[model samples]
Target chain A: MLTAIAIVIIGVLLFLANMFMDNYQLRILNLSGIYIILSLSMILINGFLGLFSLGHAGFMAIGAYTVALLTTPPMAKQMNYYLDPIVPWLAETEWSFLPAILLGGVLAAIAGFLIGAPVLRLRDDYLAIATLGFAEIIRIVFTNLQSVTNGSLGLKGLPEIEIEIPLPLIGFTLNLSACIWIAAIITILFMVRLVNGSYGKAFKAIREDEIAAEAMGINVFKHKLLAFVIASFFAGVGGAFLGNIMGTVDPLMFRFLLTYNIVLIVVFGGIGSLTGGVLAAIVITAAMELLRFLDSSFDMGPIAVSGIPGLRMVVFSLLLMFIIIFKPRGIMGVREFSWQWLIELPQSIKNSSFGRKKLRKDVSK
Target chain B: MSLLRTENMTMRFGGVVAVSDLNVHLDKNEIIGLIGPNGAGKTTAFNMISGVYKPTVGKIILGKEEVQGGQTVTVEKDITGMKPSAITKLGIARTFQNIRLFKELSVLENVVIANHLRLESNWVSSVVRTPDYTKKETAMYDKSMALLEKVGLAELKDEKSYSLPYGMQRRLEIARALATKPHILLLDEPAAGMNPQESDELMRFIGKIRDEFDLSILMIEHHMQLVMGICERIYVLDYGITIAEGNPYEIQNNPKVIEAYLGVDD
Candidate 1:
């Protein structure tokens, strides 16, 4: 019943936002939705599996490029592929948004599997560095793949994804925002289901102690690979959404900075918490957009404050430092949103004074 | 055939011999002990048998199964260099001296993870939460809780494993090993840090699990009281070589054992 209420509320809010909100606000919302998917993916590898991976942006780029190329109109493909025409087969095949997004995710998942097979053996900083290298390799490949990706010129005039489904007795039009919201909700739900299950328990076991996990017959390597591949799949889907919303794609857009921004969000939300990932993704993305003023020049009456290039990043780093220094566990730590917590909150707070006294008595016993 | 057998087992680290040409065997439904002084290669021998260290040269036979005369029988096969999980699947389970429980997981989760080897639900079913998946999980949960109860940890099943007291953590380790349903239990100094009272309790616990779980046991221990009290046969090692092997009385009285435990003239 609570889930039903939540879904209905989300659906109502989505419809209202689509009808009332301007395109700029709607675009930001869409981007945040995509980030929710990506960050959830990152948390799986980095948080649950305790593997330091820096390849999400690479996966996203693969996903976005796959969607961009597949869904681009044949005319746009002809215009963009001036340097070297896109391969005959790919240029000719114009796929719908759904299959195109799935293709993007599948391709990214394949890349993740290939990369994870070799580097999943590495742990800690080494794995981070290897994944970072893979991201760089993917970037370079996109830059040089003129025929497929249109090289540095990038691709524009990407098609918008439009799909509408009707529900009987509940007349509603599901637009792009609705689609994004639906995907985000599904991704969050899927992640929650996974992280709360036996398989998720196995991942946490491996994270806590690889040797112990292996001794318990969890197959540590296989679990790590599973996380890497699944996370990649979601990251890819998120990327496809990003391309459709932005209406452009470029290799430069998926630099290490993109992955680093996601890392900041993951850490900000707390590792091993799916709710944290979703919440932090939206908050961080909104803050990034709102903090655009820091990068722009402004005047305080007679005093002119000249804008600094990359000032946004400086502020971001400062925020990250503050969170790490003060609340190192991030907003949620490893704790999830539980109904029991809600029921117990008031009672616990009221018990604080007497609870302190009673705790000492129990411990002394 | 013996439940476990090692023939001419040796382990070399660089130029140093950690364990050298040690031959030993344990029959079904028997308890055996490996004891030695500090740096006596006792743990190294355990490591070899448990597949933590591949032997430099040896035959380590983990029991295989066969049916004989309408009854099941365990036959020995050379499992010299198998992965630890593979060895675990073959019904050999072990606990480390370090008490390497999944500390962040709840006590019940630790046991359930060990039970994962027996999980028949595939990824698709687990994701979809099909009746098969949910049923298996429910069974696993009940089974894990029962194991916790037997270990006297049912009340603390929801607690983080690391937050448990030291003795309870030690018991949790043993419970985790038993969860795998191994044919043989290899405990590497399970009683290492336990006090005399705790070690005594551990001895009873060991015997109880042996009978209850139908296990053949091989453990490395420095606790002489526990070793002499419970072990049917004991092997003594000194500097990677077996110095003595006999019944408890013979090992206790052996002059070489005394020399190794005490000290010989340089």
Candidate 2:
């Protein structure tokens, strides 16, 4: 019951913020929500299944291009495809944002199934390399599919997602960021339910020890494939949301760097902790935005450091290195945030200080 | 009639014959021991029976069911070369030579995972948390708790499995195997690191579980006292060859068994 109320309050706060925040701030918020979905998906594959998959950018590209192709207006399609002219059927076709987004996820899942069948068999570093290769292959494929993806020129003028609250007294409108937030919340809830189930245990079992999990009657390959496909589906959904929010997409947008950013979120969060991932996603996205000034020329009181083209990324890389050295398990480790922890916090604090003082007094006695 | 029988089971790893022409039979509720020195292929036999390694040449049959015509028949399925999980589903559960509990998981989770094989609900119902899935999960939870209690680990059900004491970790692994609801239990070196006194306690514990769970057990143990104390029959292997198969007394008096353990008389 407490959780239900907390969710409602958070939901209301986000809705209110949507109404008040400027467009740029809302864009960053939407981007954070997208990152939350992406990071959660990465956690499923990399953390839970113990598969170090680096092909998320590929899946996201599939999703983004799928949504772009399906939802872009015919006029925009004509303009984007001026050199190559999109396939005749795609040029005439259009779909609403929801179905297009879901289709994107479905296509990505299908791709996951096909790719996972071959590569999920590989272990550890080999799997990572294979998946990374697949991502590059996907990006290259999208680049060359001139009639389908409009070559490197990319797809532009995609529709924005806007929803109006259907209430009698207050008809409030939700823009793209609010829609993305809703999607992220749905993703979070879905993931929480999934990880709490027996399948989740099985995934963890696989992660802990694949041989033992198989001995205990879990079909390891099947479960690994299941996790991979599900992660790919969500990656696709996040990608669709990203394209919709940006109002355009290109093959270049879905690069290895895109996947690396998602990985950064997953690592900064505790790998197996959903709450940690969600919190890290928002914090990291906001931090990245806040640190944007670092990328530009700034006078640091006494010394003026000329703007380094990728100074923001350098700072993040240093932060990641620090995290790896000092806190290998990240913020929360494998443990999740719970109400029980909150309830025990005060008592634990008292025990720490008071118990120490009492011990000192006893020693004096 | 034997509950499980192996026919001419042989496993050769390239140039080395790990277990050669081995035949074993396990009856219902029988406790058998596979005792051998290091590298003697005792674990190889267990691996074959548990479907971890497929015999290069062999047939492993399980279950002797009485058909409608009053004819006794072996289950007719040769489980050789089957996947480990499928064999586990067919009512064969085994513990590792070293304790292989899901160490990071809670004690209850370690047991509950074994029950996953019998779960009727799939991932779809799990996502939506349908009533059927919830009911199954509740039942699994209750069953796992009961199993933990029977194994004397109920109080520590919420503790991480690796946090348990060494002896308790062994017991928890047994509890995990038992949760699979297997008719036959294969234990690999259950008494490996225990002292004499602890092994004695483990002997009694093993006998108690055998009767309580109505299981046929095949164990690979380096500890003779526990094996001789509990096992009804023993098979001794040396260098992938069966040297002796008999009751404890017959094996104690056998010269071949002695030579296998002690080197052939100077």
Candidate 3:
């Protein structure tokens, strides 16, 4: 019940924020929402199922390209696919954002199932390397599939989705930012429901001990595949949202660095904690934006200096290092931020630090 | 006839024969012991029977066995090469020698996860929490709680399984196996680390559960006291071959059993 109330409150706040925030702020908000979806989905596989997957970027590329191709106008496709005309069927057809995004997610899920079928059987580092290799293969495939993905030139001028709901009072346009957050909220609710259910327990069971889990009648491979496919589905959707938000996408955009960033978020948050994932996603996304200045080249007196290409990631790497050193279990460990925890937060904070300080002061006196 | 029978089951790991042509039968509600020294292929046999290792040769059959009629064991399912989970669904459940409880999970959750084998609702229904799923979940919760109560871990249902004392952890593992509602239960060294007093309690606990759950138990234990006290029949293996199979008294008096255990009288 508290969860539902909190979600509603967050929805209302996002709605208000949608109306009030400027374009630049709203872009960050949308990016944060996209990160939330990506990190939470990654958590389902890497954290919950104990499968170390580094192929999220590949799935995202599939989604972004699918959404881009399906939603772009026929004239736009003709202009975009100049070197090699898009396949006739794709060039002529256009779809609304919802169907395109759903198709993107479904395609990505299918890809996930195919890759996971063989790769999920491998454990730990082998799984990670295989998945990372698969992602690279996907990116390279997109690069070479000239007629389909417009080769390395990439896709641009993708339409922003604006959903309008007619209410009794007035009709409000659900802009791209609003759509991203709405998608994120739905993704979160789905993840929460899944993690709290029997299937979630089974996933965790696999994480705990694959051999025991199989002995207890969980088809370990099946559960691992299920988690991988579902995570890929949401990652695909997140990718679609990101592409629409940026209004452009290329093969270069979906790289191992993308997967690395999301993995960092999942790690910085507690791996198995959904609330921690959410907190880390937002904090990391905002922090990355805040640290953008570090990457920006400033005008020196005489010499011209180009910005450092990936300074934000370096800063984030340091931040993650500090997190690993200080709070090895990440922010929340495996514990969630529940309403009961919220109620006790003040007491806990006092007892852990302030109360200890007071006792030390008294002893000193 | 037996509830479960292994016919010429053998497992050869490349050059080494781990278990050679091992034939064993378990009757309904019978307590059978597989006893051997360390590395005597007892666990290897358990592994083959529980579908962890597919036997290099022979069949494992599960079906009805009329104790009084002396009929042939009916060939219901030849689960020789099935996956462990599928074998479990066919009513075989097991506990690890090392107490492989889902350690980070709660005691109740450890048991509830076993119930997942028999879940009727799919992930979609469970996630949506439809009426059917909720009813199933509630029933699963109740069943898990009842099992915890039976094992005396009801109070610690919310505590992490790893936090429980050693004896309680063993009991929780048995409770978890019981939650799967298996007809055949394989316990791998249930009394491994227990003190004599605790093993005594475990003996009674094992007997009580066999009667209560209508289960045939196959256990591997080095604790001879517990084995002798509880097991109606015992199989002794040495170097991957069965050295003796008889009633505990008969096995105790067997020259071959003594030779194997005492090194052929020097």
Candidate 4:
């Protein structure tokens, strides 16, 4: 019941913010939603399944390019020389935002299935290296595909998605930000339902022991492939949102840094916890924005210190190192946020008043 | 009729012949004991029957399959070269000598996963978590719990498998193998590290399960007392070849068996 109340409150706040906030704040919120989706995708593979895949950015590239090619207007095809006559039917077809995004996800899933077939056979550091090589290969393919991806020049002038809802008191207005936020919330809810299911249990089992899982008739390879495909599908959708939001698609945009950033976010949030992933995405996204303020000089009473140009990254790296040494499992460990925590919250509050009694009980126990 | 029969099975790892011309047969509703000193190829024979290692030369027939023609039959249906998973689906299941339970998962989850092979639900049903899948999952949980209870591990159902006491871990391993509902079960040194009391209890537990599940068990044990107590028929191996096979009375009095155990009696 408390969870329901919290959901309702959060929904109301999002709706109000969408209605009242300026375009700049709305854009930041949309970025947060995108990060949430990407982080959840990472959690599915790395956290639950214990597969070290550094090729998420490769899947995202496939998604971004797919969306870009399918959704580009016929008139603008001439301007984008890289847009070939391949899949001409889709180019001529006009799909709404949702189906196009879903198609992008499906394409990415296919890519994941193909890659996971052979690579999932490798173990530990070997799997990591294989996935990293796959990502590098994907980047190179995009860069060299002059006819389809426009080479390094990139694609531009794609149509922006506009979401509008008719309200009784107010006039109908464009609300793309609301749509992105809604997609993010839906993704989170879907993942929560999935990870709580039997398939999720199988994935965790394979992670713990592949040989034992197989003896138990798990079809270990099949479960691992499922995890990879599902994770890649979400990554593709997130990539499509990013491409549409930025109004451009370039091979150069998907660098190794993008994959590294998402991996860092997943590790910082705690693996295998969807709630932790979402929370980490929000915190990291906001922190990156806030660090921009440090660019200007600040004066103290007796001294002044300007923000060093590359100091932010150094500080961030240090924070990662510190977290690994102190809390290797991250902030939440493998636990999700449950209603049990809320139930215990009031008890903790009451215990503060009778602290001595609580202490005595603890010692006795 | 024998449920599993391996004729002239031989496995060679490069220059080292681990098991040579090993002939073994397992009848239905029987417990067979495999005893040997270290490096006597007891595990190698088990591995060959379980399809972990393809025998260099042999015929392994499961469920009355025939052996036609010469020593080498070229039929594609040979069970000797099949994968371990395929062999398991053919009513053969084994526990590792080292206790390879899925350590991070709970004991219940581990056993339930083993029960998944018999489930009628397909991949689509599992992904959507359909009502049918949920029902099957519930049934599997109940059955797995029952097995755990039978093995005296009902209290550790929710604990991570690796966190259980060593004796409980062995019991859980057997419970997991039984979850596969195999016609024949292979236990690799189930009493490896148990105390005498635990070993005695394990002997009784093995007998009870054999009767209850109607299973054919092939176990490798170094503990002679446990072997003598539980096994209906025993096979003693020396250097990859069976030296003696008979009832407990015959085995205890055989000169060759006595020599094998007592180092030739000087």
The candidate with the higher DockQ, 1 or 4, is 1
Task: Write down the lDDT of every candidate, Cα atoms only.
Answer: 0.89, 0.90, 0.91, 0.83
lDDT of 4 by residue, B83-193 (tens): 777788777888888999988778888888788778777656765678888898888889989988877788888998889999988989898899899878999999999
TM-score for the first chain in candidate 2 comes to 0.94
- Per-residue lDDT of model 4, residues A65-99, tens digit only: 88787778866765777445433454465566667
Between prediction 1 and prediction 2, which has the larger lDDT? 2
Comparing 2 and 3 by lDDT, which wins? 3
Locate the minimum summed-lDDT window of 10 residues in model 1 chain A: A164-173
TM-score of chain A, model number 4: 0.87
Model 3 agreement with the true structure over A1-365: per-residue lDDT tens digits: 88789878988998888788898888888899999999999999988998888999999999999999998999988999879988988988788778889999999999999999999889999999999999999999999999999989999888887766868789778778778888998988899889989999999999999999999999999999999999999989998988888899899999999999898999999889998999999998888888897788966779766799787778889989998999987897788878898999878877997888987999999
Extract clashing residue pairs from model 3: none
Which model is ahead, 1 or 3, in terms of DockQ?
3
How good is the docking of model 2, by CAPRI class?
high
Per-residue lDDT of B143-218 in model 1, one digit per residue for the tens? Answer: 9899989989999999999999999998999999888889899999988888999999999999999998999999
List the pairs of residues colliding in candidate 2.
Answer: none
Q: Model 3 chain A: which ten-residue window has the lowest total lDDT?
A: A297-306
Residue-wise lDDT of candidate 2 within A74-103, one digit each (tens)? 988888888887888898888876778889
- Model 4 residue A18 lDDT score: 86
Supply the TM-score for candidate 1. Answer: 0.95
Q: Give the residue spans of candidate 1 off by over 4 A.
A: A164-173, A299-303, A353-365
Native contacts kept (model 4): 0.53
TM-score for each candidate, following the candidate numbering: 0.95, 0.96, 0.95, 0.89
What TM-score does prediction 2 earn?
0.96
